[model samples]
Target chain A: MARHIYSCPLRWSDMDAFGHVNNVVFLRYLEEARIDFMFRLAPGDGSPSFSGGSVVARHEIDYVRPLVHRHAPVTVESWVTKIGAASLTIAYEIKDPDQVYVRASTVVVPYNLAEERPRRISAEEKLFLQEFLAEEPAAV
Target chain B: MARHIYSCPLRWSDMDAFGHVNNVVFLRYLEEARIDFMFRLAPGDGSPSFSGGSVVARHEIDYVRPLVHRHAPVTVESWVTKIGAASLTIAYEIKDPDQVYVRASTVVVPYNLAEERPRRISAEEKLFLQEFLAEEPAAV
Candidate 1:
Protein backbone atom coordinates (compact mmCIF):
# COMPACT_ATOMS: atom_id res chain seq x y z
CA MET A 1 0.00 0.00 0.00
CA ALA A 2 2.94 2.32 -0.49
CA ARG A 3 3.68 4.47 -3.51
CA HIS A 4 6.78 4.36 -5.66
CA ILE A 5 8.60 7.67 -6.00
CA TYR A 6 10.86 8.48 -8.90
CA SER A 7 12.89 11.64 -9.43
CA CYS A 8 12.49 12.20 -13.16
CA PRO A 9 14.96 14.55 -14.78
CA LEU A 10 13.59 16.96 -17.36
CA ARG A 11 15.02 16.94 -20.86
CA TRP A 12 15.52 20.12 -22.90
CA SER A 13 13.75 18.49 -25.83
CA ASP A 14 10.70 17.75 -23.68
CA MET A 15 9.44 21.30 -24.30
CA ASP A 16 7.44 22.09 -27.40
CA ALA A 17 6.96 25.20 -29.53
CA PHE A 18 4.71 26.56 -26.75
CA GLY A 19 7.77 26.50 -24.49
CA HIS A 20 5.96 24.10 -22.15
CA VAL A 21 6.42 20.36 -21.92
CA ASN A 22 4.29 18.87 -24.66
CA ASN A 23 1.34 16.82 -23.46
CA VAL A 24 2.58 13.74 -25.32
CA VAL A 25 6.00 13.83 -23.68
CA PHE A 26 4.37 13.38 -20.30
CA LEU A 27 3.70 9.74 -21.31
CA ARG A 28 7.42 9.23 -21.79
CA TYR A 29 7.97 10.37 -18.21
CA LEU A 30 5.33 7.94 -16.97
CA GLU A 31 6.98 5.18 -19.00
CA GLU A 32 10.26 5.94 -17.26
CA ALA A 33 8.74 5.97 -13.79
CA ARG A 34 6.92 2.73 -14.48
CA ILE A 35 10.07 1.08 -15.72
CA ASP A 36 11.86 2.02 -12.53
CA PHE A 37 9.08 0.77 -10.30
CA MET A 38 8.51 -2.50 -12.13
CA PHE A 39 11.90 -3.44 -13.45
CA ARG A 40 14.40 -2.14 -10.90
CA LEU A 41 12.50 -2.30 -7.65
CA ALA A 42 10.51 -5.49 -7.99
CA PRO A 43 11.31 -8.23 -5.44
CA GLY A 44 12.69 -10.61 -8.00
CA ASP A 45 16.42 -11.29 -7.96
CA GLY A 46 16.70 -10.32 -11.59
CA SER A 47 14.78 -10.15 -14.88
CA PRO A 48 11.25 -9.80 -13.60
CA SER A 49 8.53 -11.13 -15.88
CA PHE A 50 7.57 -7.53 -16.64
CA SER A 51 11.02 -6.86 -18.00
CA GLY A 52 10.63 -9.80 -20.32
CA GLY A 53 7.63 -8.34 -22.20
CA SER A 54 4.62 -6.13 -21.56
CA VAL A 55 2.30 -4.02 -23.63
CA VAL A 56 0.47 -0.78 -22.95
CA ALA A 57 -3.18 -1.57 -23.54
CA ARG A 58 -4.54 1.83 -22.64
CA HIS A 59 -3.64 5.25 -21.28
CA GLU A 60 -5.59 8.07 -19.66
CA ILE A 61 -3.89 11.32 -18.85
CA ASP A 62 -5.00 14.73 -17.62
CA TYR A 63 -2.91 17.85 -17.92
CA VAL A 64 -3.30 19.86 -14.75
CA ARG A 65 -0.79 22.68 -15.14
CA PRO A 66 1.74 23.48 -17.82
CA LEU A 67 5.40 22.94 -17.00
CA VAL A 68 8.46 24.57 -18.48
CA HIS A 69 11.89 23.02 -18.86
CA ARG A 70 14.03 23.32 -15.74
CA HIS A 71 17.32 21.79 -14.61
CA ALA A 72 15.79 20.31 -11.47
CA PRO A 73 14.04 16.97 -11.54
CA VAL A 74 10.31 16.52 -10.93
CA THR A 75 8.73 13.85 -8.74
CA VAL A 76 6.60 11.06 -10.17
CA GLU A 77 4.57 8.99 -7.73
CA SER A 78 3.07 5.71 -8.87
CA TRP A 79 0.93 2.95 -7.41
CA VAL A 80 -1.22 0.09 -8.56
CA THR A 81 -4.90 0.94 -8.83
CA LYS A 82 -6.19 -2.31 -10.25
CA ILE A 83 -4.82 -5.73 -11.09
CA GLY A 84 -6.75 -8.19 -13.18
CA ALA A 85 -5.82 -11.67 -14.26
CA ALA A 86 -4.34 -10.48 -17.55
CA SER A 87 -3.86 -6.76 -17.05
CA LEU A 88 -3.05 -4.17 -14.40
CA THR A 89 -3.65 -0.44 -14.03
CA ILE A 90 -1.00 1.87 -12.65
CA ALA A 91 -1.84 5.43 -11.63
CA TYR A 92 0.60 8.28 -11.34
CA GLU A 93 0.99 11.93 -10.42
CA ILE A 94 3.72 14.11 -11.83
CA LYS A 95 4.16 16.98 -9.44
CA ASP A 96 6.12 19.13 -7.07
CA PRO A 97 5.32 19.60 -3.39
CA ASP A 98 2.90 22.43 -4.09
CA GLN A 99 1.65 21.78 -7.61
CA VAL A 100 0.78 18.92 -9.92
CA TYR A 101 1.57 19.00 -13.62
CA VAL A 102 -0.26 15.84 -14.67
CA ARG A 103 -2.43 12.99 -13.42
CA ALA A 104 -2.36 9.80 -15.46
CA SER A 105 -2.92 6.07 -15.55
CA THR A 106 -1.91 3.21 -17.81
CA VAL A 107 -3.44 -0.22 -18.29
CA VAL A 108 -0.67 -2.69 -19.00
CA VAL A 109 -0.95 -6.25 -20.18
CA PRO A 110 1.64 -8.96 -19.80
CA TYR A 111 2.59 -10.62 -23.04
CA ASN A 112 4.68 -13.59 -24.03
CA LEU A 113 6.76 -11.96 -26.71
CA ALA A 114 7.85 -15.29 -28.16
CA GLU A 115 4.35 -16.72 -28.27
CA GLU A 116 2.81 -13.34 -29.15
CA ARG A 117 -0.11 -13.60 -26.74
CA PRO A 118 -1.33 -12.08 -23.49
CA ARG A 119 -0.65 -13.96 -20.27
CA ARG A 120 -2.09 -14.09 -16.77
CA ILE A 121 -0.20 -12.37 -13.97
CA SER A 122 2.30 -14.65 -12.31
CA ALA A 123 1.90 -15.13 -8.54
CA GLU A 124 5.40 -13.90 -7.87
CA GLU A 125 4.89 -10.78 -9.90
CA LYS A 126 1.51 -10.10 -8.33
CA LEU A 127 3.00 -10.35 -4.84
CA PHE A 128 5.61 -7.75 -5.68
CA LEU A 129 2.99 -5.40 -7.18
CA GLN A 130 0.56 -5.92 -4.32
CA GLU A 131 2.84 -3.97 -2.03
CA PHE A 132 1.99 -0.83 -3.96
CA LEU A 133 -1.73 -1.40 -4.31
CA ALA A 134 -3.98 1.64 -3.87
CA GLU A 135 -7.13 3.05 -5.41
CA GLU A 136 -7.15 6.03 -7.73
CA PRO A 137 -9.93 8.30 -8.88
CA ALA A 138 -11.92 7.05 -11.87
CA ALA A 139 -9.73 6.96 -14.94
CA VAL A 140 -10.68 9.28 -17.83
CA MET B 1 -21.55 14.77 -40.41
CA ALA B 2 -18.40 13.55 -42.14
CA ARG B 3 -15.17 12.25 -40.75
CA HIS B 4 -11.91 14.05 -41.43
CA ILE B 5 -9.50 11.59 -42.94
CA TYR B 6 -5.76 12.05 -42.87
CA SER B 7 -3.24 9.76 -44.53
CA CYS B 8 -0.73 9.73 -41.71
CA PRO B 9 2.73 8.65 -42.76
CA LEU B 10 4.78 6.59 -40.33
CA ARG B 11 8.37 7.39 -39.48
CA TRP B 12 10.92 4.63 -38.91
CA SER B 13 11.54 6.08 -35.49
CA ASP B 14 7.87 5.65 -34.54
CA MET B 15 8.53 2.01 -33.67
CA ASP B 16 9.73 1.09 -30.23
CA ALA B 17 12.23 -1.65 -29.31
CA PHE B 18 9.24 -4.03 -29.47
CA GLY B 19 9.19 -3.54 -33.25
CA HIS B 20 5.76 -1.91 -33.14
CA VAL B 21 4.75 1.74 -32.95
CA ASN B 22 5.29 3.11 -29.47
CA ASN B 23 1.85 3.55 -27.90
CA VAL B 24 2.56 7.20 -27.10
CA VAL B 25 3.41 8.02 -30.72
CA PHE B 26 -0.23 7.33 -31.59
CA LEU B 27 -1.09 10.56 -29.78
CA ARG B 28 1.13 12.49 -32.16
CA TYR B 29 -0.87 11.02 -35.02
CA LEU B 30 -4.12 12.12 -33.41
CA GLU B 31 -2.67 15.58 -32.93
CA GLU B 32 -1.80 15.73 -36.59
CA ALA B 33 -5.25 14.66 -37.72
CA ARG B 34 -6.93 17.12 -35.32
CA ILE B 35 -4.76 19.96 -36.56
CA ASP B 36 -5.74 19.20 -40.11
CA PHE B 37 -9.44 19.14 -39.30
CA MET B 38 -9.51 22.19 -37.04
CA PHE B 39 -6.70 24.44 -38.18
CA ARG B 40 -6.47 23.70 -41.88
CA LEU B 41 -9.97 22.67 -42.94
CA ALA B 42 -12.09 24.86 -40.70
CA PRO B 43 -14.16 27.35 -42.70
CA GLY B 44 -12.05 30.36 -41.88
CA ASP B 45 -9.68 31.07 -44.75
CA GLY B 46 -7.35 32.85 -42.36
CA SER B 47 -5.83 31.57 -39.14
CA PRO B 48 -8.51 30.07 -36.93
CA SER B 49 -8.73 30.65 -33.21
CA PHE B 50 -7.38 27.14 -32.69
CA SER B 51 -4.10 28.30 -34.24
CA GLY B 52 -4.09 31.29 -31.91
CA GLY B 53 -4.05 28.94 -28.89
CA SER B 54 -5.56 25.77 -27.47
CA VAL B 55 -4.66 23.20 -24.86
CA VAL B 56 -5.08 19.48 -24.49
CA ALA B 57 -6.96 18.94 -21.26
CA ARG B 58 -7.28 15.15 -21.29
CA HIS B 59 -6.65 12.12 -23.46
CA GLU B 60 -7.91 8.50 -23.39
CA ILE B 61 -6.46 6.02 -25.80
CA ASP B 62 -6.85 2.25 -26.32
CA TYR B 63 -4.57 0.06 -28.35
CA VAL B 64 -6.41 -2.38 -30.56
CA ARG B 65 -3.65 -4.00 -32.61
CA PRO B 66 0.07 -3.70 -32.95
CA LEU B 67 1.37 -2.00 -36.06
CA VAL B 68 4.85 -2.40 -37.46
CA HIS B 69 6.72 0.26 -39.38
CA ARG B 70 5.54 0.41 -42.97
CA HIS B 71 6.32 2.48 -46.04
CA ALA B 72 2.61 3.09 -46.71
CA PRO B 73 0.78 5.66 -44.62
CA VAL B 74 -2.07 4.72 -42.29
CA THR B 75 -5.47 6.39 -42.19
CA VAL B 76 -6.50 8.57 -39.25
CA GLU B 77 -10.20 9.39 -39.02
CA SER B 78 -11.27 12.19 -36.71
CA TRP B 79 -14.55 13.86 -35.77
CA VAL B 80 -15.97 16.03 -33.04
CA THR B 81 -17.42 13.92 -30.23
CA LYS B 82 -18.63 16.66 -27.93
CA ILE B 83 -18.57 20.45 -27.75
CA GLY B 84 -19.24 22.21 -24.49
CA ALA B 85 -19.23 25.93 -23.93
CA ALA B 86 -15.57 25.98 -22.98
CA SER B 87 -14.27 22.55 -24.06
CA LEU B 88 -14.56 20.12 -26.96
CA THR B 89 -13.83 16.42 -27.43
CA ILE B 90 -12.30 14.82 -30.50
CA ALA B 91 -12.37 11.10 -31.25
CA TYR B 92 -9.92 9.40 -33.57
CA GLU B 93 -9.04 6.04 -35.05
CA ILE B 94 -5.69 5.05 -36.50
CA LYS B 95 -6.39 2.34 -39.01
CA ASP B 96 -6.08 0.82 -42.42
CA PRO B 97 -8.97 -0.38 -44.59
CA ASP B 98 -9.50 -3.59 -42.65
CA GLN B 99 -7.87 -3.11 -39.30
CA VAL B 100 -7.73 -0.53 -36.51
CA TYR B 101 -4.56 0.02 -34.55
CA VAL B 102 -5.90 2.46 -31.96
CA ARG B 103 -8.96 4.31 -30.76
CA ALA B 104 -8.68 7.49 -28.77
CA SER B 105 -10.34 10.69 -27.66
CA THR B 106 -9.04 14.04 -26.55
CA VAL B 107 -10.70 16.83 -24.62
CA VAL B 108 -9.36 20.20 -25.61
CA VAL B 109 -9.93 23.55 -23.95
CA PRO B 110 -9.51 26.64 -26.03
CA TYR B 111 -7.13 28.97 -24.33
CA ASN B 112 -6.21 32.62 -24.36
CA LEU B 113 -2.48 32.04 -24.50
CA ALA B 114 -1.71 35.59 -23.43
CA GLU B 115 -4.42 35.72 -20.76
CA GLU B 116 -3.50 32.22 -19.62
CA ARG B 117 -7.02 30.87 -19.23
CA PRO B 118 -9.66 28.80 -21.00
CA ARG B 119 -12.08 30.48 -23.38
CA ARG B 120 -15.53 29.65 -24.70
CA ILE B 121 -15.97 28.29 -28.19
CA SER B 122 -16.98 30.83 -30.82
CA ALA B 123 -20.18 30.62 -32.89
CA GLU B 124 -18.30 30.30 -36.17
CA GLU B 125 -16.09 27.59 -34.79
CA LYS B 126 -19.06 25.69 -33.44
CA LEU B 127 -20.83 25.84 -36.79
CA PHE B 128 -17.86 24.42 -38.62
CA LEU B 129 -17.27 21.69 -36.07
CA GLN B 130 -20.95 20.68 -36.10
CA GLU B 131 -20.60 19.07 -39.48
CA PHE B 132 -18.42 16.40 -37.96
CA LEU B 133 -20.21 15.87 -34.70
CA ALA B 134 -20.19 12.24 -33.50
CA GLU B 135 -20.55 10.50 -30.20
CA GLU B 136 -17.91 7.88 -29.51
CA PRO B 137 -18.01 4.90 -27.18
CA ALA B 138 -17.15 5.65 -23.57
CA ALA B 139 -13.59 6.93 -23.24
CA VAL B 140 -11.49 4.47 -21.19
Candidate 2:
Protein backbone atom coordinates (compact mmCIF):
# COMPACT_ATOMS: atom_id res chain seq x y z
CA MET A 1 0.00 0.00 0.00
CA ALA A 2 1.07 3.53 -0.70
CA ARG A 3 1.55 6.13 2.01
CA HIS A 4 0.46 9.76 1.79
CA ILE A 5 3.38 12.16 2.04
CA TYR A 6 2.74 15.76 3.03
CA SER A 7 5.48 18.34 2.93
CA CYS A 8 4.65 20.33 6.07
CA PRO A 9 5.99 23.81 6.50
CA LEU A 10 7.34 24.77 9.88
CA ARG A 11 6.28 27.95 11.56
CA TRP A 12 8.80 29.73 13.73
CA SER A 13 6.26 29.98 16.52
CA ASP A 14 5.91 26.21 16.53
CA MET A 15 8.98 26.09 18.76
CA ASP A 16 8.47 26.77 22.44
CA ALA A 17 10.79 28.50 24.90
CA PHE A 18 12.86 25.30 24.97
CA GLY A 19 13.86 26.13 21.37
CA HIS A 20 12.29 22.92 20.09
CA VAL A 21 8.90 22.11 18.60
CA ASN A 22 6.42 21.72 21.40
CA ASN A 23 4.81 18.33 21.86
CA VAL A 24 1.32 19.72 21.25
CA VAL A 25 2.35 21.33 17.97
CA PHE A 26 3.34 17.92 16.66
CA LEU A 27 -0.31 16.91 16.82
CA ARG A 28 -1.20 19.93 14.70
CA TYR A 29 1.25 18.76 12.09
CA LEU A 30 -0.39 15.36 12.11
CA GLU A 31 -3.78 16.96 11.62
CA GLU A 32 -2.51 18.87 8.64
CA ALA A 33 -1.07 15.74 7.09
CA ARG A 34 -4.18 13.73 7.80
CA ILE A 35 -6.35 16.40 6.24
CA ASP A 36 -4.20 16.42 3.17
CA PHE A 37 -4.34 12.66 2.93
CA MET A 38 -8.00 12.07 3.66
CA PHE A 39 -9.72 15.28 2.63
CA ARG A 40 -7.65 16.55 -0.27
CA LEU A 41 -6.42 13.44 -1.96
CA ALA A 42 -9.09 10.84 -1.29
CA PRO A 43 -11.98 12.49 -3.09
CA GLY A 44 -9.78 13.70 -5.93
CA ASP A 45 -8.99 10.08 -6.77
CA GLY A 46 -12.54 9.48 -8.13
CA SER A 47 -13.86 8.24 -4.80
CA PRO A 48 -16.99 9.56 -3.08
CA SER A 49 -17.46 13.24 -2.45
CA PHE A 50 -17.18 12.74 1.29
CA SER A 51 -14.37 14.67 2.91
CA GLY A 52 -12.66 14.32 6.26
CA GLY A 53 -15.73 15.16 8.28
CA SER A 54 -14.65 13.12 11.22
CA VAL A 55 -13.74 13.30 14.88
CA VAL A 56 -10.50 12.28 16.51
CA ALA A 57 -11.48 9.63 19.01
CA ARG A 58 -7.98 9.00 20.33
CA HIS A 59 -4.33 9.74 19.70
CA GLU A 60 -1.07 8.03 20.70
CA ILE A 61 2.06 9.94 19.92
CA ASP A 62 5.75 9.37 20.63
CA TYR A 63 8.30 12.10 20.33
CA VAL A 64 11.39 10.31 19.12
CA ARG A 65 13.54 13.44 18.87
CA PRO A 66 13.32 17.17 19.26
CA LEU A 67 12.71 19.27 16.15
CA VAL A 68 13.94 22.82 15.76
CA HIS A 69 12.40 25.31 13.42
CA ARG A 70 14.09 25.31 10.04
CA HIS A 71 13.66 26.89 6.63
CA ALA A 72 13.09 23.54 4.94
CA PRO A 73 9.95 21.56 5.49
CA VAL A 74 9.51 18.20 7.15
CA THR A 75 7.62 15.33 5.55
CA VAL A 76 4.67 13.68 7.29
CA GLU A 77 4.05 10.15 6.00
CA SER A 78 0.55 8.86 6.73
CA TRP A 79 -1.24 5.61 6.00
CA VAL A 80 -4.30 3.76 7.16
CA THR A 81 -3.55 1.12 9.79
CA LYS A 82 -6.96 -0.21 10.70
CA ILE A 83 -10.40 0.46 9.24
CA GLY A 84 -13.21 -0.75 11.43
CA ALA A 85 -16.91 -0.71 10.74
CA ALA A 86 -17.32 2.84 12.03
CA SER A 87 -13.80 4.05 12.67
CA LEU A 88 -10.32 3.96 11.18
CA THR A 89 -6.77 4.27 12.51
CA ILE A 90 -4.04 6.21 10.79
CA ALA A 91 -0.34 6.01 11.57
CA TYR A 92 2.15 8.69 10.72
CA GLU A 93 5.78 9.69 10.99
CA ILE A 94 7.03 13.24 10.89
CA LYS A 95 10.59 12.98 9.68
CA ASP A 96 13.33 13.84 7.31
CA PRO A 97 15.13 11.42 5.07
CA ASP A 98 17.73 10.81 7.76
CA GLN A 99 15.91 11.09 11.06
CA VAL A 100 12.44 10.75 12.48
CA TYR A 101 11.21 13.37 14.91
CA VAL A 102 7.86 11.86 15.85
CA ARG A 103 5.80 8.72 15.48
CA ALA A 104 2.07 8.83 16.04
CA SER A 105 -1.32 7.20 15.46
CA THR A 106 -4.88 8.53 15.58
CA VAL A 107 -8.26 6.90 15.69
CA VAL A 108 -10.83 8.74 13.56
CA VAL A 109 -14.59 8.31 13.47
CA PRO A 110 -16.67 9.56 10.62
CA TYR A 111 -19.48 11.81 11.72
CA ASN A 112 -22.74 13.05 10.31
CA LEU A 113 -22.70 16.61 11.42
CA ALA A 114 -26.12 17.38 10.03
CA GLU A 115 -27.58 14.59 12.12
CA GLU A 116 -25.31 15.17 15.06
CA ARG A 117 -23.90 11.65 15.27
CA PRO A 118 -21.17 9.40 13.99
CA ARG A 119 -21.75 7.37 10.84
CA ARG A 120 -20.31 4.16 9.49
CA ILE A 121 -17.68 4.07 6.79
CA SER A 122 -19.18 3.88 3.36
CA ALA A 123 -18.19 1.23 0.79
CA GLU A 124 -16.58 3.76 -1.51
CA GLU A 125 -14.75 5.48 1.31
CA LYS A 126 -13.41 2.17 2.51
CA LEU A 127 -12.23 1.38 -1.00
CA PHE A 128 -10.50 4.73 -1.16
CA LEU A 129 -8.85 4.13 2.18
CA GLN A 130 -7.88 0.61 1.19
CA GLU A 131 -5.43 1.95 -1.34
CA PHE A 132 -3.38 3.47 1.45
CA LEU A 133 -3.96 0.66 3.92
CA ALA A 134 -0.95 -0.89 5.61
CA GLU A 135 -1.87 -2.94 8.62
CA GLU A 136 1.63 -2.77 10.09
CA PRO A 137 3.85 0.24 9.78
CA ALA A 138 7.55 -0.27 9.41
CA ALA A 139 8.37 1.87 12.42
CA VAL A 140 5.48 4.12 13.48
CA MET B 1 -1.81 11.72 47.32
CA ALA B 2 -3.26 15.02 46.18
CA ARG B 3 -4.33 15.60 42.61
CA HIS B 4 -3.31 18.84 41.00
CA ILE B 5 -6.36 20.86 40.05
CA TYR B 6 -5.92 23.61 37.45
CA SER B 7 -8.64 25.90 36.21
CA CYS B 8 -7.85 26.12 32.50
CA PRO B 9 -9.33 29.01 30.65
CA LEU B 10 -10.52 28.25 27.18
CA ARG B 11 -9.74 30.61 24.35
CA TRP B 12 -12.23 31.30 21.60
CA SER B 13 -9.70 30.32 18.99
CA ASP B 14 -9.30 26.92 20.59
CA MET B 15 -12.27 25.67 18.65
CA ASP B 16 -11.87 24.22 15.20
CA ALA B 17 -14.24 24.40 12.22
CA PHE B 18 -16.48 21.97 14.03
CA GLY B 19 -17.27 24.72 16.55
CA HIS B 20 -16.06 22.56 19.42
CA VAL B 21 -12.81 22.60 21.32
CA ASN B 22 -10.35 20.92 19.00
CA ASN B 23 -8.77 17.70 20.14
CA VAL B 24 -5.28 19.21 19.94
CA VAL B 25 -6.31 22.04 22.24
CA PHE B 26 -7.10 19.46 24.90
CA LEU B 27 -3.44 18.52 24.91
CA ARG B 28 -2.54 22.18 25.33
CA TYR B 29 -4.81 22.33 28.35
CA LEU B 30 -3.09 19.26 29.68
CA GLU B 31 0.24 21.00 29.16
CA GLU B 32 -0.96 24.00 31.09
CA ALA B 33 -2.11 21.78 33.94
CA ARG B 34 1.12 19.80 33.89
CA ILE B 35 3.24 22.92 34.09
CA ASP B 36 1.22 23.99 37.07
CA PHE B 37 1.67 20.62 38.73
CA MET B 38 5.32 20.00 37.96
CA PHE B 39 6.86 23.48 37.79
CA ARG B 40 4.84 25.89 39.88
CA LEU B 41 4.09 23.57 42.77
CA ALA B 42 6.95 21.07 42.80
CA PRO B 43 9.92 23.24 43.76
CA GLY B 44 7.82 25.60 45.85
CA ASP B 45 7.38 22.82 48.40
CA GLY B 46 10.83 23.56 49.82
CA SER B 47 12.23 20.72 47.79
CA PRO B 48 15.20 21.24 45.50
CA SER B 49 15.09 23.90 42.80
CA PHE B 50 14.31 21.23 40.23
CA SER B 51 11.40 22.44 38.13
CA GLY B 52 9.76 20.97 35.06
CA GLY B 53 12.85 20.75 32.95
CA SER B 54 11.30 17.68 31.42
CA VAL B 55 10.51 16.37 27.98
CA VAL B 56 7.33 14.68 26.89
CA ALA B 57 8.32 11.24 25.68
CA ARG B 58 4.84 9.97 24.89
CA HIS B 59 1.20 10.99 25.13
CA GLU B 60 -2.02 9.00 25.05
CA ILE B 61 -5.17 11.09 24.94
CA ASP B 62 -8.77 10.04 24.61
CA TYR B 63 -11.50 12.51 23.74
CA VAL B 64 -14.58 11.43 25.63
CA ARG B 65 -16.89 14.30 24.70
CA PRO B 66 -16.98 17.52 22.73
CA LEU B 67 -16.96 20.90 24.42
CA VAL B 68 -17.94 24.23 22.98
CA HIS B 69 -16.68 27.65 23.88
CA ARG B 70 -17.84 28.94 27.23
CA HIS B 71 -17.18 31.83 29.55
CA ALA B 72 -16.31 29.69 32.53
CA PRO B 73 -13.11 27.68 32.60
CA VAL B 74 -12.72 23.95 32.52
CA THR B 75 -10.88 22.04 35.23
CA VAL B 76 -7.89 19.84 34.60
CA GLU B 77 -7.18 17.34 37.36
CA SER B 78 -3.72 15.84 37.17
CA TRP B 79 -2.09 13.07 39.22
CA VAL B 80 1.00 10.90 39.18
CA THR B 81 0.37 7.40 37.87
CA LYS B 82 3.90 6.02 37.87
CA ILE B 83 7.27 7.33 38.95
CA GLY B 84 10.26 5.59 37.52
CA ALA B 85 14.00 6.15 37.88
CA ALA B 86 14.33 8.31 34.76
CA SER B 87 10.73 9.09 33.88
CA LEU B 88 7.26 9.50 35.32
CA THR B 89 3.72 9.22 34.05
CA ILE B 90 1.03 11.82 34.67
CA ALA B 91 -2.62 11.02 34.24
CA TYR B 92 -5.13 13.79 33.79
CA GLU B 93 -8.81 14.53 33.34
CA ILE B 94 -10.26 17.59 31.68
CA LYS B 95 -13.68 18.04 33.14
CA ASP B 96 -16.34 20.37 34.42
CA PRO B 97 -18.63 20.12 37.39
CA ASP B 98 -20.53 17.20 35.97
CA GLN B 99 -18.82 15.87 32.86
CA VAL B 100 -15.39 14.84 31.66
CA TYR B 101 -14.22 15.99 28.24
CA VAL B 102 -10.91 14.21 27.98
CA ARG B 103 -8.79 11.58 29.72
CA ALA B 104 -5.08 11.52 29.02
CA SER B 105 -1.65 10.52 30.25
CA THR B 106 1.85 11.62 29.47
CA VAL B 107 5.26 10.06 30.04
CA VAL B 108 7.78 12.69 30.97
CA VAL B 109 11.54 12.39 31.29
CA PRO B 110 13.41 14.92 33.32
CA TYR B 111 16.32 16.49 31.50
CA ASN B 112 19.32 18.58 32.42
CA LEU B 113 19.29 21.56 30.10
CA ALA B 114 22.88 22.49 30.76
CA GLU B 115 24.15 18.93 30.59
CA GLU B 116 21.79 18.02 27.75
CA ARG B 117 20.92 14.59 29.03
CA PRO B 118 18.15 12.70 30.80
CA ARG B 119 18.49 12.58 34.56
CA ARG B 120 17.26 10.27 37.23
CA ILE B 121 14.67 11.37 39.79
CA SER B 122 16.53 12.96 42.64
CA ALA B 123 15.87 12.14 46.29
CA GLU B 124 14.34 15.52 47.02
CA GLU B 125 12.39 15.55 43.83
CA LYS B 126 11.16 12.02 44.44
CA LEU B 127 9.99 12.98 47.89
CA PHE B 128 8.13 15.95 46.47
CA LEU B 129 6.55 13.85 43.76
CA GLN B 130 5.68 11.04 46.15
CA GLU B 131 3.30 13.38 47.94
CA PHE B 132 1.23 13.54 44.77
CA LEU B 133 1.70 9.95 43.65
CA ALA B 134 -1.28 7.64 43.21
CA GLU B 135 -0.35 4.52 41.28
CA GLU B 136 -3.90 3.76 40.19
CA PRO B 137 -6.18 6.57 39.23
CA ALA B 138 -9.92 6.05 39.68
CA ALA B 139 -10.51 6.02 35.90
CA VAL B 140 -7.74 7.74 33.96
TM-score of chain A of each: 0.94, 0.92
TM-score of each: 0.95, 0.94
Question: What's the DockQ for every one of the candidates?
Answer: 0.95, 0.96
lDDT of 1 by residue, A1-140 (tens): 79999999999999988889999999999999998987788655355488778899999999999999999999999999998999999999999999999999999998889899999999988998899998785653
Off by over 4 Å in 2: A44-52, A138-140, B44-52, B138-140
- Candidate 1: regions farther than 4 A off: A45-48, A138-140, B45-48, B138-140
RMSD of each: 1.8, 2.3
Best by DockQ: 2
Best by TM-score: 1
Number of the top lDDT candidate: 1
Please state the Cα-based DockQ of model 2 relative to the true two-chain complex: 0.96
TM-score (C-alpha, index-matched) for candidate 2: 0.94
Tens-place lDDT digits, model 2, residues B59-124: 999999999999999999988889999999999989998999999999999888778888888877
How accurate locally, in lDDT, is each candidate?
A: 0.90, 0.88
